[model samples]
Target: MSETSSSVLTRMGAAFGSMPPALWRLLLVLAVFLVGGIAGWIGRGVLAGPADVPTMSVYEDWHLLCPALKTKDGACEISQDVYEQRAGERLARIILAKEKDKSMVMYVTVPLQVLLEPGIGLKLGNDQVRVYQYKTCTEEGCLAVIPVDDQLLASLTKAQDAGIDVAQPNGKAAELPFSMKGYADAYGAFLNNEAKRKSWWRRLWS
Candidate 1:
């Protein structure tokens, strides 16, 4: 070998000789791993194009469906003050339809495009959740019968805001906010109307 090559080899040999046998073996293994990784990375880059990365989205003031009796500009017009004023006064029940001889049931309407099988997710405030199955669907939308059970009524009384988790076919889900400002008052008034009030049923016949 040439003098320069021989000198480089001699220096390397001396350095390795000074290193512990275990350390030398470890370093050799590490060097091999690094070389293999680099080779694999280069090979992958040569074989494939850059990957498609998903983009994030940020929307400003997305319009939601109004849950109040009144709405303006796709938003609920009734504030907490208004809700308090008309809470019990506006409590009126409309019997959707009576089964052949079955009792009338209360119902809540939902928007179209909702998956009917899994039912709807109802979250009262930060906690207290329940799922109500769809009763039936019309051209307007689907209906969910709200049971006036003790727990549900109690939850509404303490809840400031409620959520309806709408299921989508694409696996992406969405939540709709429903203000429970005067829900308890209205529901209480409805409960007082025993003559009009009917047993809660899972399905609507009409």
Candidate 2:
């Protein structure tokens, strides 16, 4: 390997070495569902869309994404793309969506080269850290779906910064940071759009 590549790998090994065994075990258990691919199914359900072109609206750093052909049950989400600084390559995409039951979910998609055993880490604001297992892998990348409870939702709305951490196959750790500059406004618009759609559907059925 080139000197630069070798140097990067060395740093990764050192980082992983410093991690406690118990932490590794905890991450492993959290990621156990990866074997069954249940999260993959859920990812598909949440992200899949018809062939029609999608529409996008920007709210500062976040985007309001919706399907082109609108129906009563059309899907929409707030999203942002993270990029690698040096190479300017797209690193990951973060998505936030609300379920029919009003629960929130966040999907983090990273490169296919990610290490699945350790799953991934989510950092919100200063001290909160959440570890999530990989739900599935596709040609695009691997995905981790995080269920957002009320507390987590509040954190996201209030956090000024957020990041996703992943381990590389070579044992290197990478943190992909995404901005929360307009998350609250984007999410509010998402909720309003969802409510309008649901109300229209109910009126039709009624």
Q: Which is the leading candidate under lDDT?
A: 2
> Model 1: per-residue lDDT, tens digit, 100-162?
334333355566777888887778886746787988888756768755555665666698776
Candidate 2, residues 55-105: lDDT per residue as tens digits? 688999899998644454577899999988799999999998867666779
RMSD of 1: 22.8
Clashing pairs in 2: none
Instruction: Give the local distance difference test score of model 2.
Output: 0.84
Give the whole-model CA lDDT for all candidates, comma-separated. 0.52, 0.84
Query: TM-score of model 1 relative to the true fold?
Result: 0.41
Local lDDT at 188 for model 2: 88
Residue 41, model 1: lDDT of: 82
